[model samples]
Every structure is written in structure tokens, then in C-alpha cells.
Target chain A: MKIWCDRANNQRVAWHCRSHPETAESNAYAEVFQLQRSFIGTSPVHVPTVADIQVVTRRPADERPAVILLELPNRHLGCQTYPYDDLVQISRLCRAANIRLHLDGARLWEIQPFYNRPFADLARLFDSVYVSLYKGLRGTVGCVLASSDAAFMAEAALWQRRLGGWMVTSYPVLIDCERAFNLNIGTFERKWRKMCAVAAAIVQATKDFTTSDGRPIVYFTPEVPTCCQVHTHIRGVTRERLAAARDEVERDLGLSVFPWTLPSPFMHELDPDWVLVNGDPLAVQGMDQYFEWSITDKNVDIPDAVFAQGWRAIVTVLFA
Target chain B: MKIWCDRANNQRVAWHCRSHPETAESNAYAEVFQLQRSFIGTSPVHVPTVADIQVVTRRPADERPAVILLELPNRHLGCQTYPYDDLVQISRLCRAANIRLHLDGARLWEIQPFYNRPFADLARLFDSVYVSLYKGLRGTVGCVLASSDAAFMAEAALWQRRLGGWMVTSYPVLIDCERAFNLNIGTFERKWRKMCAVAAAIVQATKDFTTSDGRPIVYFTPEVPTCCQVHTHIRGVTRERLAAARDEVERDLGLSVFPWTLPSPFMHELDPDWVLVNGDPLAVQGMDQYFEWSITDKNVDIPDAVFAQGWRAIVTVLFA
Candidate 1:
């Protein structure tokens, strides 16, 4: 495990180190499993961090691998989804190595537009697949694991019980997920395209503005985002100004823009440039502020008027 | 592990075998861990099933047990809460043996009234304790683990993430649980006492009248229950009849009686005589002819008129 992790690039670090303040970067070496057995670190790839399992499987016959776990749309990297070629290569590598592959497709729903494939067809690449109902699926709380191996799934079920995931009453979550899926999944691709269009328009409209220091007032972390989600930064604005304008945007336009801070930051990336200004988002409100947002079925149809009002409010707060 | 399970008795099958039809009874020998490293089987004893540390500690000087796991208020035998003596003895044994003891206190709330002690004091007996929020606490879904060992807890926290138990947004559950704890925990003891009184009265009122085979119509499984919850058998009545009567009782008396089946029977006990009669009660229509109810704060003060009407409904449904 140590040997495999060491083979990765120097920049490779546990995905958690990005958000956990206590996690030292030195200790974030991309070890698959630590001595403690509990601290398995994540590989630093884009949202869909596809592993070419062959890289690890090339080891001596005596050191054959056990399992290869892949995240379809890695949540940490702006929900970046893997392409079919990456998945096919990994699948072939696992097949050759005779190691089981597990897909952590938490945000697989968002990947559909990029892949243009059925969920089941994509799932067939791995020995087992876990699709979350919450991330982008809008479930109250739930996930599902699918595989052709009945015995393996049964074992998974047992482990779920041992881990306290075997809920007494999960219907509330199940019902909510089902409803959300029915309402949202059908038009996700169209929504994604629409979102990309809106994002492009916003970028074009704001490209001319500059901060006092001359940096672009509105900047996209990735000049062109691959999916519906984009990490954004407003250079001249404090978190407080963005937050105040956030309420006004919703009031005037009935559309919500991303707040600089969220109660749960683990779900998003870590950006050090941002500073939390005011208000308690969680139990005690105070933490670094960052900006992120996604276009989904729910928000794909925001009217031009609303977007204009929201952008205007944000600009007014920062420049007025 | 096989030797220990074999000694427990033939009726001492794994708790799961009672419900899982695929699990053969003969194969139920309690193996502590399988070759794959998964732990299986529950102890056959009631609450506080203590193993004299001397038994294992006496083996070779090199052989030492790492941990002792105990389930307080054993679920199968009617949530039997452990006494203080049993807890003290187990704690002493664990300390002397140098083995960590963890308590599966899923129904710890139910133990408070019986032990007449504080929750923290009971928690101190074990190295770590897992208390459920959804069981008697009535939360949507959550649990709390208490331990003085920071490293061990940190390790456990890591395992929680690996097992997908580290949710993106658990505040929904946390907030609901907080609301429930505030509303319920304060007056739980008073409510419990009241419930016991009501249960006793119901038992007395419906004790007589035999079936065609001479079995009593309203029979308590244990004759007298050890806790607030009692498994009741309403003999010779169809599931539909009981379901109808259940609704009538709620409407006429504002008191609830348990339906024969629940959506998640794994959290509850196994009662083989009754079958899952119909729809998912958690989402839709209810089922099962068997009846069970608990004396809790919510229903402790059920009016005498309501109780009388409920009894009448049951008798009328069964005999009419």
C-alpha cells in the first residue's frame, strides 16, 4: 500500500488535507492505507480522479492488489467527471490484475451529460458501484450500491449494518430521493447545457471589471468549467458584501447565488484567499469564505431578469 | 469462536438467524470473526453478558484479548437493561484484563428509568459507548459515541468516513434529534411509570377469554414484561381486523397500538407467529394482526375512556 501511494506524483496528498486544518501537509502523503488501517488517504485527481490501476498492478506477482476504488465525479475537484476512456483503461487494468474495482460515484448524476451513457452501462465497468442519493440527487439522506455479485452485495449489506448505516426507518430519505430523482433526473442534461450557457454569459458580462489592485473582479477558477459547477471568486468583494447582496438577489429575483461561506465546507473545495466576514452559518458562525455554485434541474431556468438583478446587486455591493 | 458459540446452547443462534430465512439454524454457531475479518453473531445472554476475564486471560501469557464488546439492554430478550452490579463487575474485569470494553447502548435511553442513574455514569463503565438517537429518543436518524480515549475516538471517526457514515449534511438529523431530546428526555421517567401502569391495566383487563384451542386471546409473551415495551399476541384475529381496530382506537381513543409489522424489522425483534400482512406502514397502509405498544411520555397519559374504548375495539374485533 505504501509503495503504491509513493508512486503517485509529489503533489499527491490526501484529499482531506484540503479542508481539515489539523491535517498537516507532510502527513498527507497519498498512502492507500496507513498503519492505523483507518486513515486511508484519497488520491489527488480532478473531480473524476480516474486511476490507471495498471500503474499499481505492474508490481511483482507476490504483491498483487486487492481492490481498486474510483470516484466517478470526485466531489473535491468541482465535481469533475471521468470520461469513458479513463474508466475503460482502469477497468482493463483491474481485470488484468484480478483486483476488484469499486466505483464511488457519489455525483454520478451530474456525469450523465458528460458521458451520454446509461447509469447501468457505466456501472458495469466496476465489480461494485456506490451511487449517492444526496449529492446533486437532492435526497434527504441515502445511497445505493449495485453489482452483479449477489454474495458480495449481501456482504456489503452486512457491513452496512455493522457500520450503523442500517437505519431503522429510511423511508423518509428513500421517498425523498425517489421524488427528487423523478422530478430532476429526466432533464439534467438540458439543465447542464443551460447552466453552462448562463455561466458563459455571466463571465462575458463581468470580464471587463477590475479590482483596485487590477485583478479581474469576477474570476473563474477554471477558465471554462467541464460540468454544471464552477468555482468563482469576486476579487473586490468581502464575504459580508456578497452575503448582504445574496438576500437582496433572492428577494428581488427569486434566485439564490452562492454565499461565500457554507455551514458544511467539507462538501466543497478549500480556497485560502477568501475570509469569512460575519453571521453564524453553523453552530457558531465564523470560518473562511469561498464561492461555489452549480447549475442543476432546479435552477437551470432562472429568468434573465433574475440573473441581471443578482449580478447588479453583487456589483452594487462591491463597487457602490 | 466456534467453541464459545457451541457452549451457548442450540437455541442460542445468531440474533439474525431468527429473521433471515437463508441463515440455517445449524450454521448459527457464534464465530467471533470470519476469515474475511468481519465480526458476526451477538451474545445469547441478556443485558450485561459478562465473560470472566480469567477465562480468556488465563490462556497463554502471550495471549491477551484486545476488546470486550457488550450490548446494554439486549434487544432480543425484551430490552433487558443491565444492573449496576453487572456493569461494575464487567468494568473491573475489563480493566484487570487490560482489554477495552465498548458498549452498544442503542436503547440506552430505555435503561435510564430502570437503573435510576445518570447516562454519563453508565457510560463510564465502558471504554467507548454508542447510543442511538432514533430508538427510544425518536430522532430522524443519528447516534452518539462517547469515549475518553481521544486516539481511539479519532480512529473511530476515520472509520465512520470510510464506511460512508460521514454525511455531507447531518444537521437535518442533528436538529431533529435535538428537538426530540428536548421534548422527551426531561419527563421520560414520569412517562415511563405512567406507561407501566397503563400496560398493567390493559393486561388485567384482557387476561381472560381463551381461543378455540384454549390459548388466551390477549396474551403477553413474557407473561409480565420487563420494560415499557411488551410484545402482545391477539390470538385468532386476522391482520386486517387488527389494522382496522388499530385505526378505530386511534380515532376514538387517541391512543395507538402497534401494528403487526414494521418497515424495518431488523431494529425490532422477531416474532415468528405473525406474518407481514400488507403495505408499508412507514409510507402507506399498515399491516399485521399482532399488537405491541410502549408506555412512553407521548401515550402515558391516555385517558381511561380511551383505554376502555381501545379494549372494547379489540374484544369486539376478536369475538364479534
Candidate 2:
């Protein structure tokens, strides 16, 4: 297949993806090792994404492939709704457009804890399931890519071998797979419950505080908002005043917290219309006390009533 | 894409590639799930090959898929001169008769130590290579199928997800994949070297001790054969005789063993060609002594060099 594309000079976003332009310049057919994504601009974190795949698949008129591959998120994202791999959504699109959809479910093992379901229950949903020996199962290392339709699986073996994946002695991986199959269900259930419980508790403890419009302060969201995130605001309430209030709350609640990394104070005029606190972790106990003061003690309350300007906590937790 | 033929359900020996009535009933669309392959059969184990693929492809069967998939040996069988997946052979066969051949290397990692070559080097020989995190590498259960061609990869990913191999939060798999990639290579390498050395030592130890036709009271093989392999003959030897011999050998050598598992006096045929001495195993130190015995003892002087051979003994230095 003959193709042409531009080169990446520095750390810049490519036409379809972000990569070193020099890579594309050198090899017409090398993996464009994705370094960083364009989400939350200029943040240094690795997250290979569906959006990235979407961009590349729509690269050119001629280059559009017969199929587009993507990992299917569990039906729910931690019981909270967010940007999820909508199989139902995309499958219809693919069928209408005549483009095939593929799923990469390596962490299917870890996926189940979110649903209170079994791995097998979730796996049956996919066209083909490539299950690993070790990952969620903690097996030795190996995977079995299976499908309900025998024909497709029979043909896929060709690709498996072509990719240098065919191996001998699946015995070791069998060990891991078996362990995951037999042991993981319970472990995952317990851990998932714990993770959900902790997360829910944190949300509940902090939800009693909200923005002016009455949106819950500590809200649990299935979907991270698009381009809407939390940031620092230091206009109305001086850092010192906020710090003093923080100290008072901690003294009342008996909690310790770092000064930096705490949410910044806001002046009424400069306060955001919808002041949203993000998933970014903050002083948990202090947050708990801040809300405690907002709700319990009315007489000795401070002058900063914007926070107390008739607020109610909204706790949205993925798990109970 | 209508096609021709299916894999035969004929017993292992009778199932060499061919059109069969049995196949018509068992495999509808040339789809095959070869479960019985793990058995290598007896000594002269051979690779099953197809003949007409070359002649038919000469004219290019337009309706047929351009690709044919095949499975490879389990690594425990180890690599020999052919390195079955070696593209030179497949490509040569393809070029000679005009066809394309792909591999199903799902467990290719185990096959590596036997090849004793770098992974990338072996990968370069194939049109594509698939690696699993769960296989020997013990990554999250998934396969990373790579190809010399980017277009092929693009095509495969669609199948991958369609097959339900795609997963969100495969980050867990990546973490384990990194661990597998880093940890297994060395462990596999060391194990392979140790096994091969053990096999080689067995061969040399029995080289001078074997009868003209290469039968020994106790011998080894170049093939890093499986545990419990055997072939041998001794005068008047029965099951008990073999057991006695094993017990005597271990006692004299200060090693541990199960005499009952060995070939014995009454069990030996008058003319014996080969008998597995249960793939004799000893500690690292004992193995070194085994090598020394191979070098120092040119021909063990059979004390009762007659028809009714008696108890065997040797060396005056009390080496035990």
C-alpha cells in the first residue's frame, strides 16, 4: 500500500494524532508511538484513547479502512456515566456505515467489579474476546482471543500467527487464566465494593457544599465534563482568610491537610458562576469539617456566607 | 466469499490434509479447531504439510482468500533446524507455488528459547507477529499483534475489537505487559539453557555407554524430550531390575530417585532399541558429576559380561 504523510518536527500534534513528525517521515509503516494526547492541553500523561483512534480512522478518504477497532468500555463506567465505549451506539453506526467494530478488552478482568457482574457475562457481548493470562487474573502471561462465531476465530488464527503471537506451552498461561477464572471473581467483588464504598463515602462527606446554583459540591460523575474542570480563584477571599477558615474547620473537625494543593479562595465578584470541585483530591477531613460547619454551627459562622448562601450537599456516588 | 473444504476429523495419523467426507460433516466452512495436536505421536514426529496449495495457487484462485493460517509447535518441543514459523520456508513455499502463508503464533514466547535468537530478529522473518500479555509474559490477558505492514495492523485491530478483544482500562494490562516483557525474557532464557544443558549432558553420558545401536542401561537424548521418556535394554532386566538399577545408581551416586519408575529386569525385551529412563534428573551438582562420568568413563566394564548379567558396580574412590 503506497501512502504519503507529513513529518512531525517537535512535540506537536499531527494532523490526525500527536507524535514525533520524524517518525512518520522515516517509516511509512511504523507504529506512531503515542506520547501524549491533546486532552487538557499540554498535560504530561499517557492515555491511549478512542478519540485518537477516531481521528486516525478518519484520516483520509482513501485511507479509511474496512474496519475500525476500539476497546469497549464496560456497559457502565464505575456505575457513573461518562464518555464510555458505546458498543450499542457505535455498533449501530458501524452497521449503518458498513464499517466493522473491534474491541480490545485486555482489562476485562478488572472491568467486572464495576457492574457487580461476572466476566463471562460481560465477555459474551463482544464479537471476539481476547482474554489475557496474567493481567486482571495475574496469570503468567498469555491470552486466548475467542469468539462465539467459530468462523471468525478460525480465520483470526492467521493474524495471531502473523503477529508472532502463536506460541507453545500455553500451560503457564492456563495457570494464570484458571486462577483468574476461579479466584478473581470474589477478590474483584470485594475490592470493587471497597473502592466504591471509599469513593462514595468521600463524595458523601464532601457533597454538603455546592456552587451558587445549588449543584452538589462533591458530586460523583460517571463522565468527566468536556473542557469543564476546576481551577484556582483568588479574588474575594484572600489566601490568608481561606487558610484561617481552613484552620478553624480543621480545629473543629480534627483533621490535617497541606496548605498548598488545597482549593483556592474566591472573592464574590470573581467567584465562578458554577464553582465546580473536580476529582482532584483535596483535604478530605477538612472538607468534611467545612461542610460540618456549614450545616451544624450557625451562631459562630464566619462572614463568608457565599459558601453558606443556602447550600445543600449533593452526593453522587457510583457505588452505594 | 464462498470457499472450499474443511479440516478432517480423521484420527491423527489419517488426518493429513485432504478432502474427506468426514470433513464435510464435522467442519462446514474449512474452520478447524485442532485439539489433538498437543500429542506429537511417537519418535518420528513430522510436520503435516499440504501439497496442492502450491500448484493451485500457480493460477491464483481468485475466489480463495490470499492467506492461509497454520499453528506452530509448543515451545516445550523446542526449536530445531527448521524453526517451523521461519518465513524463509513459508515464503519460499509461497513463492515456489504462488501463495501467501500466515502464522498463528499465540504462544510464540515459549518457542523462543529453543530458537536461541533475538525476538526482533525472529519477528522480522514473519509478515506479522502477535504477542500476548497473558501468555508467558503474564501481561493483562490480551495480544499485541504486530505486522511488517501497517495496513495489515489497521485491518487486524478491527477484527481484534470485533472479536471483543478491545477493553477500556487496559492500562492494567499495560502495567502487567511491561512486567511480562521485562521479567520473562531472562527467566525463559535461563530455563532454556538449563534444560538444553541437561539434555546434552544426558546424551554425552550415554554416548560411550550405549550398545552399538545406541541403547544404554541409562542414556539421554538431544531432543530436550519430555519427562518420563524412555528407551533401553539390558540382559535379564525386568521392571524390578530397572528399579533395582535406578536404586543402585542413586545410592552409589549419592542422588535420590524412584527405582520403581525405571525399566526393570523382566520387562526388558531380548533385543531392546530404546527405553526412556524417565529422563533422569539430578541436582545441579549431580548433573556436573554426570558430565564428568561421561568424559572419564569411556566404557563401563560390565562385571557379568555374559548372558545373565548381575549387579553393576564401579570406581574405587568411593565417589558416592
Candidate 3:
């Protein structure tokens, strides 16, 4: 990602991307490149609008942003993706402005069922696309970057050598990536179906519960997930209480409800607003916890009723 | 190596090291850091003398070299190491000059039998030391850099993160490294003993052969084994003739004499002198081929006589 951004920016300093709570972007911009805090112009949405690109790019020729980065089905926003038309418009805008478009497709495999588009078709919309072999493919570790530009890839190869990414022996990782990709790529649609059924069951079970301040106790960002992952939020529960409930439920019912939870990320972290946005009621009230719930073949065999039962057990212990 | 050099050099640009045929130094200085051609002051010897250090370091306060890099048992110079007393004197000189010193100890483990000193004692002579876990230790792959300065290591850690050296998983490589180290570390002295025997036999077998120009056809660079590796030079053989002879001998005797050979590196590549050094007769004549012959457990089991026989056959084929 750093290599791509550095090459794409090409002496122009600024870049634009949607505002989100991913640590990777901050790590690359502020830590690696040491770019100024103001160098990243952001829009507060899963997908940036055409107008947002214009606003970010409206600068003197020397100051204009060199690239725009977009995450497919932004995970922080409950795996919600741009409508295909919106993406086409954004791609066209960047092309017209001579700005490069990059895609962070770490979760691309999970979202494939929702888009029903070939990977190549989706990748064609961006100047460069990065995909992880370990994320949905269940490989040991590694990633691939695709681009039509030969010069860009050649530069990436040089950076790879400079960074010591060329290992003496990588056959183990490569073999595992191939095996997992072959075994798992075709199973995402099935996993998505199972995830939707589980989400629906849990929603029905927790619908009647509410916080002391009268907000619903349990809800999901986007309400209906567009992919196999969703952000599940539980209001009126402190992080400590949720942890304790999680442990008790696991011990008593032999079910691990969620791996972990954290207080909802503040809206200000994703945007410049000093005041919390009313749209994110949990962050405004300050007593909500959330975790990313994702599905894969490992969890697809568990009955949907079991998911509802596990959440019910945790909620009972939390409200007790 | 890049991270250490960058940190040790601080603001001052100039640095000094003995001139040698290793490509690693050039890659780091010219390719990675983009240092100027004049930044590296060279001494044309395996071990830079105290006078050489004075010459390289005598500069304005702002222009003095920030660090000196030394390769143990300079591989290009037949693995000939500096005498311990000379090394002690050089260490004192660098200390008085307030210049950091680094050791490229890629072959440190192989030389341990000759030095008969603890690894820690040898490493203590420099501010930073780099040892290859793969080379003499026979690990799958990886290297370790040692430094007493905590801040320097912390900076390396940050560089590691920025360069993506921190892999998602590394247990397999770590386990293989440990296994190889344990299996091979204690066997160096035994391997050294075997290599010395092999070298002696080859020396006796090729003593009678002569080049068309009457130079000795075969000679060991150091004329005796210092460690498990030696630079074996064939004075009359061109690279192509040696390669063809190698194939014929391997096919007929089922003995692989040397993996590959290269035309002897020009003396001018290591030193600025346009005229070849009188001491290196093979380079002066321009018809020599050489290969680094390293001994390990795998080759130790083969009879020493087999190595002599293989070389005799290859030489006979070359002369015919």
C-alpha cells in the first residue's frame, strides 16, 4: 500500500479517501510517509461521492491530489458498498481529473456474492488493487497487487527487494495460498447465506431489549448486511460488562458469542466534527459496544438457532 | 544493513570500508540509499590498516565519516581475517574518532574454529553486528542483527514495520532456523577439519599442471584452509571450458566438482588502480576462473580422495 501510494502521488503531496476507522491508512500516511495531517482529504461515508472528489481535488495544479483510495464494502461501515453506478461515476471522475484510483480489496472475496461481478471486472475500475491471500482465502500469509501499468509493477518489485520482502523460500506460503484459494473461493456465497440467516435470528431475539435511556439494546449497522460481515452494536452495555457477559456465557453455554468488543469508535475519529453525529446514537450516548461479526466455512455448520441462543444468553447476563 | 547504516551515519554522509568484490555494499550504498559515488572511501585490503582509517577519517568535523563497515574474513579475499591485534587497534582508532563501527559477520560462524573466541567476544568489537542465520548455520533463511543500543534497535523495529518485514506468521521459519542452528553450529570445527583435508589433497593433485602461459593451473587463494570455505582459482581455464569440463566429469564419474565458476573479478573493481595488482597473478593475466568452495555436513561424508579425483579429471578434460 505504501509503495502504491508513494508511486501514485508522484511529487504531488495530497491524497483523498473516505473517512473510516481503519488503522492501516493512518499508519501509512502519518507514520510511514510522514505526510502532514492535512494531506488526506476525506469524505464521511462508505463510498465518496463525485462531489467529494471535486472538493478534494479543487486546488491549484501543483496542490491537487494525485490519487484517491477506496475500500470495497468498507468494513467499518458494516460491509456496506457503493451502488455499482456510484462507483462507476467515481472512477470516471478520477480518470477525468488525472488522479489515480486504488482499491483496498482485503475483504473482496467476502463481498463477491453481493456484487455478483467477476473479480477482474471490479479490479478494472481502479488503477491498482490490493488483495490479501490470508483474509478470506485462509492462506498462511501474503498479498497480491494487480495493475495494468508495467512501470508501476516494476517499481513495486524494486521496493519489494528494498523492503526484504523477498524471502529465501516462500514455497510453503505459496502452496498454502493455492490450496486455500482453490478450496474456499467458491464457498463464499454459501457462507454469506448462512451469515444472513444467523444475523436475522439474532436480531429477532434481541429486538425487544433496550438501554436504560430507551434506545434499542441490539442493532446492526446497515440493518441488512451487504456481505458476510456486519458490525453488531449493543447499546447500554459497557465494554467491561460485555466482556464479563461474554466469558460467563462461554463458560456456562459452551458457546463463544463474539471474540471481543470495544466501545464504539467516536465519530470525530472518522470525521472532523467536534460534536457527535446524531445518526450514530450509540457513539453520542457513550454506552455502546460493537464487534465485527464475520462468517466463513468454519462457522457455517452451526445452526442459526444456536447463534440466537448464544446472543440471548449474553444479553441476559448483561442486563442482569 | 540499510537501517543500521542510515541510523549510524546520522547527518554526516561519508563512510569508509575496505574495498572488496562483494555486491552487497554497492547495492546498499548506491541502490538503496542513493549515496554519492565519493561517499564511500575505500582501503584496498582485506583488513584496513590504522593508516587507512586515518586517511579516510581525516576530514573537517562536518565531513568526517560517521561509520566504518568491516566484513569478517573478507570472502572476496579468500576468507582471510584480520589478526586479532590489528582488529583491536582499529577498534581503538574508531573509538577515539567517535565513529560507529559495524561488522558484516555473514561468515562469522565458519570462522569461529580459527578465532577460537566466543561469538559474544567477537561481536563486542563493533557497535553493530550482522550475522546470517542461513549461511554457515544452514537455516532455511533469515539473518540477525545485534546492537547494544536500545534506541537503535527501536528504530530498526519501526523500519521493520514500515518495510512490511513483520509477517503475519513466522513460526515455520523460526523453527527451521532453530533446528538447523542446533544441528550445524557445533559441527563447524569438524567440517573445517574435513575441508582442510580436501584442500590439501586438491593442492597436491594440481601442483604439476600449468597454464599455456606457464602460470600454475590451480591454487587455493590462501594456500591453506582458514575455515570451511576457500576461494579455489584455476589459472588457465576460461569459464566456458571449466563449465564443459564440469559437465563431462559429473556425467562420467558422477562427481560434481564445483557448482559453477566465474571469470576472476578484475582487481580494478575492488581497487581504483587501472593497472592490475602484481600480487594477483591470475587477474593480471585475465584467464583465471574461481568459485567459492564451502564445506558442510552434506559434502563432508564424501571421501577427500573423491574431491582430488574429480578436480584431476576436470583439469585433464580442460587441457585435452
Candidate 4:
């Protein structure tokens, strides 16, 4: 089994270098590629970046491909969706190559608000798309795989029957999921904005603050156009704190917020270049204020507290 | 396609005489046979019962079998959960042949209380057991297809994936189904006994009184069996009054109930056999005197009424 990843320019050196304080980007790359090769032969391919897989599928090589996947980019909060421009291009390529495109849309519902596209239009492009009711739809259990009636009828029933998913006698989970999907999904985009703003404030506040472990406070970088950034200092954390953070993030946003603390940033899921934001949006805002106050008292030429406060307020309202 | 029907003996005779009932049973069978010979390219053949489909699969004389289904003997609560005596024999035949066994176990859960067997143990005997979550479980909607995980992973998934069944997210449905499955099951037989006793008293008292429908009443009979003993003349009566009876039954018994009405006695499912006592148990005792007094002369059947009164005192107190 072969794997592929982007060997793009690093940020600290060139414009594209991942702009973080510690743990170089090269090491991140190596760790991710290594973990994925572990599950290379598994049915569900271990991918760290959707773009990485996309890059390979669109490699313009002459070899016949068996199956192609539409996977998520970084599995993180406020993680922007896969590149739509690249996605349509990939679909065209797969169609040209006569290859099957299967979508791993576990986060597909959450993705639409970020990408600014309708699910129906996106759904039409793939030969088959797999979406989990338990994920973005907020079901306790179950998943859906959709495609053309004939082609889908040929394989999915056979697989679900074989996979032990068909034994579920009734669909209470689906009904609950439907309510959550219909009622709560509309506000996701607004919430995403709030998270991004709060994350920006956090990094600005903690510009020089260190944690108990003596590492600089890490914040998410909204990798807008040219660059992407993830925070440093992953270790020296207690299990309690980690769990608390996950719970807080999920509760506040009413959705799961992963990238809580990964062994390596780029492992497990093929991550999209994300505008990393801390799950603790309120705490980030607080940190921003602290930085503004401390720096100004020292007579530093940093941005003013009023500006910081205004930024945080905007972020809070956006998420709210 | 060979079809196994319980009343196929009567059905064949009726069809030959040009006098079959409009029930789905007779019409559905004839249509199914037509489709088998034409659309499905298999000649329609009749079997006495589908206790075994192994016969046709092994001794395929000419045509491929269409669908081997039996007219399962109805208790007319829409359930026919027989003991292992029949099922185990059927399963052995299924295992030796390539034929798929599809259980029309719509109220399969009803069988659980009568014979007392684990659901999985019974499910293991069939290739695919179709269980409706609503019938006995009181779920709002949904059915389950239970089978081997290997079969699910191998064959069933392909069919589910291909069918539009893949489009549905299932968590909500499962939630409701499992909630009903966990909470609403049990006490069926206990309530059933109460209903049978009450019916026995009524049948003994009101020989001249016709039910809302014209059908005559019987306690538990061998042909109509236990579940259909409550058959009344009001089969097509408004659900408003039918529901009132349901509420009354619940009020007296404190258990839930299921109501199944059939077209006619000649239809067999309508044959008065047993009162379906699926609802609250005490409710019937509380309401039995009201029924006995209202339908018969108040002076009649003093001994039977006194006996019923004694039964009500014990059962309701025990239930309480």
C-alpha cells in the first residue's frame, strides 16, 4: 500500500512554514506518515490529510486506481473543510479515470457551513457517500451510505448486512438525529466565526505567558490563504485536564471538538490546513486581555487592550 | 416461486371454487404466483406449509424458486411465534440447502414471552429474521433484519448499500425502538390470561348478544388460538371507541395491549379463539363486570360472575 503527503514549503523558513514556536514541522510530517503506514492495509485507510489523498489521486499517473476516498482535512475544531476547488477537480479526474469515488463524510454535515455549499450538490458528485448519523447529525448510533439506487442497491445492503449494521430493528436513533440536525445545525457557521475570533485573541494574550510545564501557551492560527498553524506544547498535561477540555468544548459548541491532544498533530486523520482555535473560546478571550494589560503596563508597543476587548466581544457574539 | 401457506389447503380449494376472500393472503398469493411464473420466470407451486423450504431447494425439478414463504398459523394478534419444535426443524432444512430463510416474524417479540427464549438464540436459526419494532415492542416506527455479522459484512451490506435504505440515518429510530424494546416488553402472557378469563365469563353470559361486529365470541380455541379469542363484531368500527376499550383495559389491568382485527371468520384470522391480552392485566378484571352486566341480563350467570369476581380480586391484587 502506498501513501502520499504534501512536501510543501515549511512556514518559519518560507511563507508556508507552520508558524509555531516549538516542535519543527518536519518532525510532524514524519510522525504522521509513519502512523498512517501502520494501517495502510486496513479496510479504512489511515489518512492524516484529505488533501494528501487528493493530491495522490490527482497525481496524473497512468496506473489504474481501485477506490478513491473523500476524507476530512484536520480533525480539529474550526477545522475548515476540504478544499472545494480541489474536490470538484478530483471528481472530474476520477470520472475521467473511470474510478469509484467514495466519500467518508463523517463530518459532512458540519462541513457544509464551512465550505458554503449545499449537501445535495456535493452529494451528486460522488458515486457513493458514507455519512454517520452519530457524528454531525448527533445520533447515538447508526450511519447512512447513499448513492444511485441501482449501484448503491448492488453493494451497500450487502455490506451493511455483512457488517452487522442491518440488525438494528428500529431507528429511534435516526429520529433523534433528525431533530438535532433540523433544529441545531443552522447556527454552526456563526459558531465557527466565534471560535476563530476567540482563538486569535488567546494567542495574542499568551504571546509570552508560560504554562505550569514551562512551555509557551499554544493557540490556533487561522491558516487563511497562504499558511496554516498549530500550537506547540502537547505533553505534561493531566488526563483530567484533557477530559475537561474536551467536555467543555463539546458542551459549549454543542458538537465534538477533537485535536484535543494527539500523539502527533498530523496523524489519524488527513488534516486540512486549519485555522487552529482552542476549544476554550472564553479562556482564550481572557488570555488575550491579560496579555494586553501586561504588555502595556511594561511600556511595550503592543496593541492596546481596548482593541483586544473589542476583538474578543466580536468573537463571542459571532459564536453566540 | 413455491409459496408455503398455512391455509393453502383451504386457499386452493377456495380459488378452485372461485370464492377466495379479499384478504391479502389469497390475493397476494395468486399475484405472487403470477409474478413468479412471468416476471420472476418460476412456475407458481403450492406447499401445505413452509415448515421447510429445504425440499424445493434440494430437489429442484425445473424452475428456480421465487420466494418460499409460509402462511404461518396465526394467533391473530398478528403473531405466530411457535416453539423450537417447528423452528429447529425448519432451520436444519435451511442450513443444508442454499435457500434463504426469511422470517415473517412481524411480532417476533411476542413469541419471546410465551416460550421464553433469548432473542438472539431464536434469530440464529434463520438466514434473515425480519422483526417489526412496533408490533409487540410499541415502537413508533422501524423494523430490524437480524443475521450473522459475517453475512452482514459480506452479503447484506451490498444489498443495503445498493437500496435506498442506505440514505436513512438510523440513530433516532433505534432510540425509540430500543426504548420501547427495553421498557414496554413483558407482562404479555399475564395480561393474556386475564383477558382469556374475562372472555370466558363473557362468552358464558352473553350467548345471545352480538358484539359490535356480528362475530360470535369464543375463549381459547384450537383453531383461532389464544391471541384472537377477543375477536368481536366491531372489526371495522371507529378507532375512537376501539381506543376507549383499550384505555378501559389499561385502566383495569395496568398493562399495555395490542388490538388486531381481521375481516371474517372464514378468513381464519378472524376466527374467535383467544382474547389478545397484551395490554395492562388488571384493566380487564376491573372492566369485565361492566361488560358482563351491560351485555347480559343482570340476573343471569350468578355463579360465573361470582367466580370472575374472585379471579379479579386475586389477579388485580397480585398485579397491584
**Candidate 4, chain A: TM-score against the reference:** 0.54
CA lDDT of B231 in candidate 3? 86
Candidate 3 stretches with Cα past 4 Å from truth are A1-9, A13-22, A25-45, A266-286, B1-9, B12-47, B212-214, B266-286
Which is the winner by DockQ between candidate 1 and candidate 3?
Answer: 3
TM-score of chain A of each: 0.69, 0.43, 0.86, 0.54
What does chain B score (TM) in every candidate? 0.66, 0.47, 0.86, 0.52
Select the stronger candidate by lDDT from 1 and 3.
3
Q: What is the per-residue lDDT of model 1 for residues B39-131, given as tens digits with 9 covering 90 to 100?
A: 222332222234433454344433444554556665544455556886788688757755566677777786677778788888898877878
lDDT of 4 by residue, B91-134 (tens): 67645554445555565555454445676777777655666776
lDDT of 3 by residue, B4-94 (tens): 4465554343333333313433343544444433324233434456666676566554566567777787777678777777777778877
Give the local distance difference test score of model 1: 0.55
Worst 10 residues of 2 chain A by lDDT: A1-10
Q: Per-candidate RMSD vs. true structure?
A: 11.5, 18.3, 3.7, 17.0
Q: Write the per-residue lDDT of candidate 1 for residues A183-268, one digit (tens) a residue.
A: 76766677667666766666666656675557656655445655676666555444676688777767876667664553223323
Candidate 4 per-residue lDDT, tens place, A157-261, comes to 544433234435434566666776676466545444443444465557544544555754444423331112122222333434544654664566543323334
Residue-level lDDT of model 2, residues A1-320, one tens digit each, is 00101111222122111122221132212322222222211211122343444554445544443444333332112222113344344445444443444444555554455544566655544455655555445555566777676767665654444332344534445665687667654454444444344334444455555545565544332222111111222222333455665565456544332243233221121213323333222232223112111011221122223232211111111111
Of the two candidates 1 and 4, the one with more favorable TM-score, higher being better, is 1
Give the range of the ten consecutive residues with the poorest summed lDDT in model 2 chain B. Answer: B288-297
- Which of 2 and 4 is ahead in DockQ? 4
Per-residue alpha-carbon lDDT of candidate 3 for residues A111-209, written as tens digits (9 for 90 to 100): 888878888878889999888788778897878888999988887776666546563467767778899899988788888888788889998987767
Model 1 residue pairs with clashes: A47-A74, A48-A80, A280-A285
